[model samples]
Target chain A: MNDGTSATVTEIDMRNTSLRDLNRQLHEATSGHFVVTNPRGAHAVAAGIDSDIVVELRGSVGYYAAGMLQRGTVIVDGNAGTGVAENMMSGVARVTGSATMSAGATGCGGLLVIEGGAGARCGISMKGLDIVVGGDIGHMGAFMAQAGNLVVLGDADHHLGDSIYEADLFVRGDVASLGADCEEKEMSAEDVDLLTQLLERAQMTADPGDFRHFGSARQLYNFHPDDINSEVAEARS
Target chain B: MTGENWHQRESYTFDRNVIAEIHRAANTGIYRIRGFGAKRRLPTFDDLVFLGASMSRYPLEGYREDCGTDVIIGEGRAERPVHLDIPITIAGMSFGSLSAQAKEALGRGANAAGTSTTTGDGGMTPEERGHSKTLVYQYLPSRYGMNPDDIRKADAIEVVVGQGAKPGGGGMLLGQKITERVAEMRTLPEGIDQRSACRHPDWTGPDDLEIKILELREIVGWQVPVYVKIGAARPFYDTALAVKAGADAVVVDGMQGGTAATQDVFIEHVGIPTIAAVPEAVRAMKELGAHRDVKLIVAGGIRTGADVAKALALGADAVSLGTAALIAIGDNSPSLEDQYQALGTTAGCWEDYQDGTDPAGITTQDPELSARLDPVVAGRRLANYLQVLTLEVQTLARANGKSHVHNLEPDDLAALTVEAAAMAKVPLAGTSWIPGMG
Candidate 1:
């Protein structure tokens, strides 16, 4: 617990260290503040970190920089690569800069906040995580998203939220095009209240009234029993 | 009757099946899709003959001496490596392709034989997992039913880059097989055909694959072994790359391996034969000095105990069975002849496994059809078959005067045909000369 001593952050130099050893050490550690310096675009930096600690990575990173993250505060000082925080279950991942494709993809639970623009397929196949993107998002944003809330302050590129399910998508700026089965819906007062809280968590400023909400139409897959036309056909046959 | 004396001459280039395939393709405008391995005849273990000890070495007693059969997979990598009583392990077959009972049967049989069984494409089933003492969960390109929790529950993880039947092609689970449970697990609509992606979503090349292995190792705390399985397109390079990618075990699958669904053309045309594939993989391991250190498991058409013995003698640490395993679980039993007749196919001749109307109940998802085969009986049958195979291997080893099954080598074998001699790199019978060797 390190309760006996004053909380001291452990500094690690990433220039000559192995990521395998680094993640292993992180998994074993119960409580401590960790600072990773000179990441130098390392892939899988602090990956699979599951302890209740904090990690500050000080550089642009490569793919899966903080993948499958759980119970930690991971802050990337610069731009992150593909699949950053991918499949993360819990805790927080705050990126000071932008992220590449599939940012926060397939994450179950967590708060992933990107300050700058995100590349294509942001929040793809999201399970339950809440993502707040400050700037623009590229094509196919939240494609096939199953669950979670994606809030984008800036523009969204083509085919946003294609074949989405359950997940709610909110964009403030212009959308190039909407994808199949994803349609705009009336934003209730409840949505605005939720957006305001999420923005406050990300520490970003944006008017909740300006955002437009979009979600699945459930045309291909009907959630209700009465909506199953094929089952009825089979029953009649 | 008089005109029948003049029979029509058939062209050798365009045979009956070729003509039928062309017409079928023309009619359907799609390739012929089916299940099972290559139907065409190819060079196999039958071309090879064992050289029993006569005078040069004394043969061991029939029942007195013990020939060690126990094999330890993932020697240095895994924290808890699997200890197999025999060298034969059950190959991965998905739950969607085979009924849950069939999966359970495979697990029970492999477990009873003191070996391992693997899970394939659609993910782990509780019945299969519960029965299997040692289970290898396959992580495929599609990632269908893939989650971190299932990966954690597995004893070993096999990263499947390719399968033998469709090396460059994707996996196809037909609409008929897409039961409600399968649709839910794969996140697809019910009664719709599904195709697995050819490439992994996250990573790309071999370099990236190496990183993925490292990530998996870290995620599992290095407790379970990570295996890389590849089709036998180019065994030497593929085995070398898999070794370079830091695999605990490397599995090479030849053309004769079965699939749930694939194009018949691909099954017949793609990939090398098992006999041709083994030596190249062995050569790669030998070149890298990783022969025994990193385990080698060969699959495809490994049916009998002699096949297992031959694969081991050819430098593989173990062998895997898929089609044979299905047969053990009563896939084409003669007892199901009445049902097979109703399905319009003879027993042991059914290849339309993709249609999901299997009469034997091993490959069907229909509740009534799947209920025909009992797991306990099927499992016992498979266990008996495995025991016989193990005994046969032990007999061959004793005949060669080898004290252990692993000690069986090329010196105790010779090939009958020139191609077999060249492929197997063994001397021709009654001669000390290998065809290609100087």
Candidate 2:
């Protein structure tokens, strides 16, 4: 079971195994390292792993890879489809290649490191999951993000962090436009330190000072009668 | 004109309610938000009447004969299908929308009745899970308070696509109801207006939903059933899509379904009636050859056992109760008339659930108001109500010469109005003609 690493290894070939058996085994294992080969864009690869195990998918994964993962480590060596690591609670999920829409969506607690770019809504509705992207992210990134830290090493597309709450966004390059209620803020020493630590964890060499911070304006938290008409008009446009 | 014979004319379009709403909108510059279902009437189960057995078919003895009320949901697909003592079950209502005591009572009652209770938009709470024998966890668009550990604790999982009151809109919990505890669970600031997302954050469409269902199945180890719940917008298509998306059961909620907080306009104007939606959903399920295998639970405006029986006859496997269940738990009680009047409304007509000043304590976050409700007492009331409903259904089924409630079919029913006949696809009373059949 040993595969050069100190931990015991369990090898699973996706071509020969059913998705059910793979996840069931992962769920039951208390502690082990799982090496999955030939994932080949299969959805929900390594989803719902609750135990404190480590899973490494060798190839591309389809939608919801490592979804709702808890107390585990899932590393996808290739590109990920939509909603990778979605709603993950307390785990580490890494995508070596780019991820599609809603990566790390609604995650309560976790660390998701994407070595490449991400699609739209990269961290939509994210809660307390730290996502570090090595490359640029698409529009509407971090939309309505509740609580989390999202760090993008490259430029961001338009309308980032629409209707966000509490979540912090740090981007290094130019952003097309800010979303409703999302605004750029001056980077403080704390922001710098947080970004620096995230970068080091993701293994991306970027100066924390180069990144600008963004957060919620908190204007839309409650209903305001006076601003209703204008906000509605803005939404329509 | 005589002193007592004077008359005043009023336009139907500009009625008193309309005038008041217009004035309120003009003054506030905001739409009216409230709770409860549609106030306007539509063709409903009340328009349908069951035909008891006569000389040709012998009826079972009303009190002496046994008529089964038990139902099994998620039979074929799920490893453990839910077994209910009655065909009626409680629908999803959030902990944030209701008091914790109210949630606990619902669980306690459902447990006593041998049925299931569902968790709502706010996610599963310990009170609900601890009290109920069977609990269905709702996977909402918000994912607020959603975690893997809680998902594993559930007996069933319901993927909420939409609600009946506002089919295409998100959920609304006004600032007044968002207490410190609610805020912590939902990861939001206390006393802020909360708007839950309309569409799911991760997936969209049936194709994506299929994958989503698979993920959930994997999460629960395929031990619990997965139900896809849709507001009855386009029931036929939605039911078919849900079946194709790998649901063990389908829940169709019509326009008459209740809400904790929603715009008054949306509640009245959107979606079809419950009776209208059922037949179409049934047709789709039958067409897919997945009719009974994938159980159907219909909701909205289901008050009496007659409504439940009619729904079953129209091809529903079971019926869910929302507003009616709240009534059973003492919401809008006439005993609280004085307090209701203090809030500028009568007890029976009160709909300002968004205000968090509920006199009955069923729908408020204020500790004092919530404390007015005793969980044990409320639970007993709900259990008694459930027992009465079950007895009524049994009486009707025995009269129809059915051994079980599920045996009642469309042939045993007739509609009173032409609209009802057309919508329910049943023949009109005293006539063989069904308006839409020809």
* Highest-TM-score candidate: 2
| Per-chain TM-score, chain A, candidate 1 | 0.91
Please list the residue runs of candidate 1 whose C-alpha ends up more than 4 Å from where it truly belongs after superposition.
A1-21, A29-34, A38-40, A50-54, A70-73, A100-112, A117-237, B1-7, B432-435
TM of each candidate vs. truth: 0.85, 0.96
Tens-digit lDDT string for candidate 1 (A48-131):
777788889999988887787877889999999888888787899989999998898777778999999999989887767899
lDDT of 1 at B291: 91
Fraction of the true interface contacts (Cα pairs closer than 8 Å across chains) found in each model: 0.11, 0.76
**In candidate 1, which residue pairs get closer than 3 Å at backbone N, Cα or C atoms, i.e. clash?**
none
**RMSD in order of candidates:** 5.1, 3.9
- Interface RMSD values for the candidates, listed in order? 7.6, 3.1
lDDT (C-alpha) at residue B97 in model 1: 91
Reference-based TM-score, model 2: 0.96
